[model samples]
Target: MNPLLKKLQELTTKLDSTSETLDSFRVFHGRGKIYPGLEFVTLDYYHPVLLLTLFNQPPEHWLNENLPLLQENISQKIQTIVVQHRYAPGDPSEIVYGELPEQVFAKRGALSFHLNLAKQQNIGFFLDIEPARKWLEQQAANRRILNLFAYTCSFSVVAIAAGAEKVVNVDMSSAALNQGRANHLLNGLDKNKSQYLAENILKSWGRIKKAGPYDLVILDPPSFQKGSFDSVKDYTKLVRRLPELMPSGGLVLSCLNNPDLDDQFLLDIFNSACPQATFLFRLPAHPDFPDAESNRQLKMLVFELATG
Candidate 1:
């Protein structure tokens, strides 16, 4: 047996052991957990598919050659396997095994999202933030939500399902927002109660503020989207303006995905910008994406405004 194949077999056995605990839809994070050189993800286990993302270097011939063997070892039937090279931005995924689907439907808890396996670069949802979605559902009753950088509006759908009064989803990409609309309909939620805006977030404060003061404000942004945001600088800018949009006693869910910046980085910004706001708690990362180092993990912190 090949060395890489042997390692893959061991990982598959581990995944099977915890299949029930993972809720059918789970992520097997391999970036820093199993394989240091690449980031391997099983996007969905119930209707199986694999995503092999190369973060460190160019693709190796051996990994490609042995993918079928890896596929065969798994207990469940895998629909397809997609490979993404993070180092090469414009490059398309190399389909190493089976046929690629135009779209794959994945369910997380009660909500479901549509993923474009072959066309879109991203599968369209962040699996690591599953805990936060579950948490937000608990907090959604009778609250108006402002979701900034609302890619695919996963948070919006979860909130609406939990009885949110209204939600305004703002993002630069109209295409992504359209998918968000589809996600809402997929879950049998009313699209009329939600507003979708395709505008630049920083410059569109005039438009975004009109819909506020919101009860729940969610900020989940990309770490570095070249021209739009540089998390290190702009995240603080967004935090500084929070008081203007949120009402007294309102809640803010701030998400930071930059591996370089730790949880304290966002805490410092929140404390300095809104001293009256209380740091509630940090959302725990998904068990599937466990890490030895704390900073490398995804950070999600909830803060509440001072009512008095």
Candidate 2:
């Protein structure tokens, strides 16, 4: 048996047991674990498809030969297989096996969101942010939300599902925001209660602030977007303005995905910029995507502004 196959099976057993309720999740994240530069996940599990993403380097020729063995050995009944290369510039994801669907929906709790698995860099919804979604649902009741870099508005769906009064989703991509609007419609959430702003967040603070005095502010941004955001340098700028957007005693769900920066990077920024805002806790990444180093995992810090 191939060593990778054996490890995959073992990991699948552990992940599948607890993930029966979930329709989309990371089956493996092997950045510095089971395999270097490889990630394997099952998306739209209800539709039943597998996605294999390669990072750090291009895939070896052996992958074409070995993927079949992998598909045969896996426990789930995967109808489609897609492969994406993270570092390859402008390279489109390929459907390695079976047919690619026009649309795929994945369930989390009672809500379902569309997943874009073809012709894009991202599959639309991020599986690793499941913990934050769960947390938001628990605390979202009757609160106003501002979701920054709101890719496809997955968080908005969670907020709406959890009875949020209103949500504003801001992203630079009009296409993404349109998809977000569709997601809200798909879940039958009131479209009037949500606003989709398609503008550069940093430049549109004047516009964003108008919708604010928000009860819960959620920030989840890309690690690096050329000419847009550089986490180490630009993240602090967003942190400095937190006080202006959120009201006293409001909650802030801040997320950072840059592996190079540790949790303290965010903690220190929050502590310094908004001294009154207290760090509540770190949201845990799903167990299925464990990292050998906790700092490298997706970091979500819940902070509450001080009440006067």
Against the unseen true structure, what C-alpha lDDT does each candidate score?
Answer: 0.77, 0.79
Error (Å) of candidate 2 at residue 94 is: 1.9
Estimate TM-scores for all models: 0.87, 0.89
- Could you say which candidate leads in TM-score? 2
**Native-to-model Cα distance after best TM-score fit, residue 257 in candidate 2, in Å:** 0.4
What's the lDDT for residue 86 in model 2? 61
* Model 2: residues with Cα > 4 Å off, grouped in runs: 1-4, 7-22, 36-46, 56-60, 74-76
RMSD of candidate 1 to true structure, Å = 3.2
lDDT of 2 by residue, 274-300 (tens): 898889899887786677788888898
